[model samples]
Target: MTDVAPPVSRPKVVRHQLERLIITGELAPGDRLAEVLLAERLGVSRGPIREAITALERDGLVVQIPNRGAFVRVVSEADARHLYEIRSALFGLACGLSASRHTGSVDIELRGLLSSMRGAAERADHEMYFDLNRAFHRTLLETSGNPFLAKQYETISRSINLFRARALTIPENVAASLEEHERIAAAVTSGDEERARSLGASHIAGGFARHLGESVVAS
Candidate 1:
């Protein structure tokens, strides 16, 4: 009798799982990631693990030393701030472009996410609010029809998960963040690109600054 081989899963599936592990702090910054251990834990072969590592490296979440192997990159507040700065600029540009080019569907989608964010905030559901926050930003960025801006936004989006976890720990962060998003939505709806961009930048930069201050106090 011939032996049947197990079906191979796509690399993207492996990549996504690993991405979640990093974002949720399961695989924390500076954590050593051994291929053997990961393969065992994930119940997969080393091939997919290696591929996922490569993908993570491309996303700046992992760094592979010449001979030492892969380690999760520490996301410092400075790093977070830098990412937000870039995100702010790109987001601003996208919103400005969107001011003149937003499609009807895109506007509808943004409104829907805003509504969902309001619901999540009202219920104090941090995780759901976090997801909606991402959707709100992504929809706005993509709605501009600027593929380059969208790509940059995706790069910055990965860092946001860390902040979400931090913000949720604070008593009033959910309401404050929801309010900020509301301002952005209003600006976009009103066709005020400058207002949207300024508000968006301040919202992101303020969060990073607050997190930095909190980390210092804790330390």
Candidate 2:
């Protein structure tokens, strides 16, 4: 008897691959995503690629026009500022909630992340640091015990990947960002809700400032 293989969700797989391409700067901002080309590259049918594109569009990672096809979304300065504002508020709330519900295990996990981030920074490994940074924030949000807040935070984070990739490239920014994370962790672990909220908001605001500075230098 021949064994039947489990069905694979091609569209979901394709979407993740596309997302990685964008995050790694392979697709890049403003790059046109041709359906046929993607289908060929990913070894999938164009139908799945089309569906993946639609999903990415809903995620704010791709822009689809009536006749122009799909392109990686180019987040403008205005969009960056707007996203940062929303993220700051959400992060503040998440931190406050986490602080009010802190546990010893949660504190230990956060400290472990901080240690990993320090190691990443010392090696000048921006990519590793970026992953660790994301994990740290996500862990705090999860501690909030509000799935809704975590979902919203994730959506906005995906939309701003371009800005983050550039912002984390600066060595100075890497060090400063780690320090901010340390302060945030300290506030949460110490059960200081107000301080955690303020530090969380300020951390995101600092990233926004750095993004603007980088944009200015680039342009």
Candidate 3:
């Protein structure tokens, strides 16, 4: 591994890097966070790594054992279902509002985002696809003209930031997700508020089903 230069705030920087690794699936759920090894990999002492691990615990990205050290977090079946249900509601409303409030100006931006997402999905670039997926949804939320609702969505989104990337692990999920996006986009752009809302909610619900099928949840 190439060494990283030590930063003034090593713990913060290390935490962000570790968060990226876990969220991007490089450090898959249930993988251990070996402090000594990570210290060597990141060119820092174990102190920063330990500190970062503590922060990750608070961020809901890692589970810390009494003596075993940290591991990437695995969401419980109940927790996973709960989060998806909340997002389904919020996103469904956002999609409806986007269809009702938009004035046709966001079409170009949405189209460009969809094109990029298609490319990323084709290449199986889950990291890129995840980011673009967020951007696409954020754009729709913003077009809804509801700042309070958007703020609530973002808060909930950050709580499950890591969970979202894992859903794209299946190759077929990429195609299915893109197809859903296309339909949602069409409905929103066509000012079909009810259809957009229904599709938005179902899309989120479908992702959860795919995730469960792919072994993310326990029986």
Candidate 4:
């Protein structure tokens, strides 16, 4: 019998884990990221952790200061707002494109996401709602058939999801968010390109505004 080899660690899995740590404030902004500490905590070798750190740096989740090694990236209200603006524009264009150009399967996926979101909201399951939200947006972007647009959308969306999750968890925010999702899904299904784009942009902007209003900035 041939001996089986252990599976190699995927660079992406490491990157995503580190990214979530940074985003969720488990590894807070400006907190030092020691390779040995992270490796021990994650039950993995330092090699994969280092590779993950490099990828996180590229993704703006970690920044290295001179003579100081890696630290989580800090986000200010202004920075958050600015990032949301870029995301809104990207998503808006993607939604409009998808509405105009998407085939049958994309529409079906959108409806499914809508149903799932409705159920999640009714159950008050924030995590599931958040996951479905990301899926919905990604589906719309993917259906656009513009590789550049889809790639950029995913990059921006991942970067902001941490803050967005916190913001959306505030009282009443989830209900409001579900309503917005319904509007977006309706517009997309009806092939209302302009309406879908407009609603999508508004949804992002409103969510950011709500977050900024409620958030207490800590230094």
Candidate 5:
């Protein structure tokens, strides 16, 4: 009879925690990821911390410098713009498919998210709305019934999330986004594929404007 401890998954756990900090802005862009400090804070050895950092780098959430160690990546404006362009196409397609494929429960869930999102906007709860906003988009993608599209969108979303909170910086912007989401939800739920496609693509475009600067919101 052997009492064997399960295989250690410390690095995977550390990676998820570190990834959340980076996404939620606790570890801001350009923040140094000192392996020793993280190792001590997470109550593990430096080996696991280093392994986690390497994983984050591959996820495009952190960067490793030859001499300076790892840092949370600062997503550039140009890089964000390109990512947005690709997301717009994918999201629009997903919306069309979702409209064609969504079921009753999916419709109810989207409506619920819209309601929560509206309340969050009214209360100026940007963080809450940000989470719900991501949920709303993910629901549409998942309901689209295309696993490949969902997978690609999820991968791109991790990078976009580094700066997504910036999109909700102003109360006015939140209200605008709420309106856009309403239209998107309506289009999807009503089985209007073309409308859903247009609004979905345009929403991501508007999101980029809000993220970078609010000036283009009206455009």
Candidate 6:
């Protein structure tokens, strides 16, 4: 039998790696993403790098300037607020659906994630808490059983990643966020759809307020 090589999607691989770089803070917002540099670093040619960059741009993770080349998108405070508003609505819907469809196993899983997040926060591990926080919300959305809602939330969540970590870095914020998560989990597990929806929206709003406060401090 002739040996057939498995297909390699270089552009997709490059895109994933680039996304990790951005998410992990190795490539911060406003950092220039030079095609040549990325190509060399990823051990891929410029073609694949460019293709991956284009994909990221379409995903709202990168911005291309006419004269300044590509860079990680710098989401402004106003833009973040607007995005959070949309996200708040979507999260509320998803949580409401999840509350309506709650199961013992799903509830247990979410509670476990919240516990882990609390531990991370106690240890002052912002990165670990951030990742767990994402998992907690993602689990809720998936449990919602509404594919369209999940898809829309996923898109907004990705864009929100550009600023989510910054808001959670404050110790007090982390503590308060855990409390909110606890209430959200309680609502979902208890099958309180309205309360789940309200709490979910309020959580996002709180994050938005914290982000705005951070922007003010930075300015």
Model 5, 1-219: lDDT tens digits are 999988758889988778867776778888999988888888889998889998888888889999988998888788889999999999999999999987899889999999999888888887788889989989999999999999999888887778777667588788888899999989998999999999999999878878877321111
Ten-residue stretch with the least lDDT total in model 4: 210-219
Candidate 1: give its CA RMSD in angstroms: 5.5
RMSD for all candidates, in order, please. Answer: 5.5, 3.9, 5.2, 3.6, 5.0, 4.0
The residue pairs that clash in candidate 4, if any, are none
* Model 2 clashing residue pairs (backbone): none
The C-alpha stretches of model 1 lying farther than 4 A from their native spots are: 1-9, 122-125, 159-171, 213-219
Cα lDDT tens digits for candidate 1, 16-133 = 7787677656777778889999888888889999999998888887889998889977777667777778877787777777766666676788888888878887787766776777
Which residue runs of candidate 3 sit more than 4 Å off their true CA positions? 1-13, 45-51, 64-69, 159-163
Quantify all predictions' global Cα lDDT against the true fold: 0.74, 0.89, 0.85, 0.79, 0.85, 0.86
**Residue lDDT tens for model 3, 6-51:** 6568689999889888877778778999999999988999999999
Candidate 6 C-alpha lDDT tens digits along 83-131: 8999999999989999999999998899799889989998999888988
Greater lDDT among 2 and 5 belongs to 2
lDDT of 4 by residue, 90-114 (tens): 8888878887886778778888888
Query: Please, what is the TM-score per model?
Result: 0.82, 0.88, 0.81, 0.87, 0.84, 0.85
lDDT of 1 at 106: 69
Where model 5 places Cα greater than 4 Å from the true spot, the runs are 1-13, 40-48, 214-219
lDDT of 2 by residue, 4-41 (tens): 99887878898888987887677888899999999899
How does model 5 fare in lDDT?
0.85
TM-score of 1: 0.82
**Lowest-scoring 10 consecutive residues by lDDT in candidate 2?**
210-219
Q: Largest lDDT belongs to which candidate?
A: 2
**RMSD (Cα, Å) of model 4:** 3.6
TM-score rank, highest first? 2, 4, 6, 5, 1, 3
Comparing 1 with 5 on lDDT, the higher-scoring candidate is 5
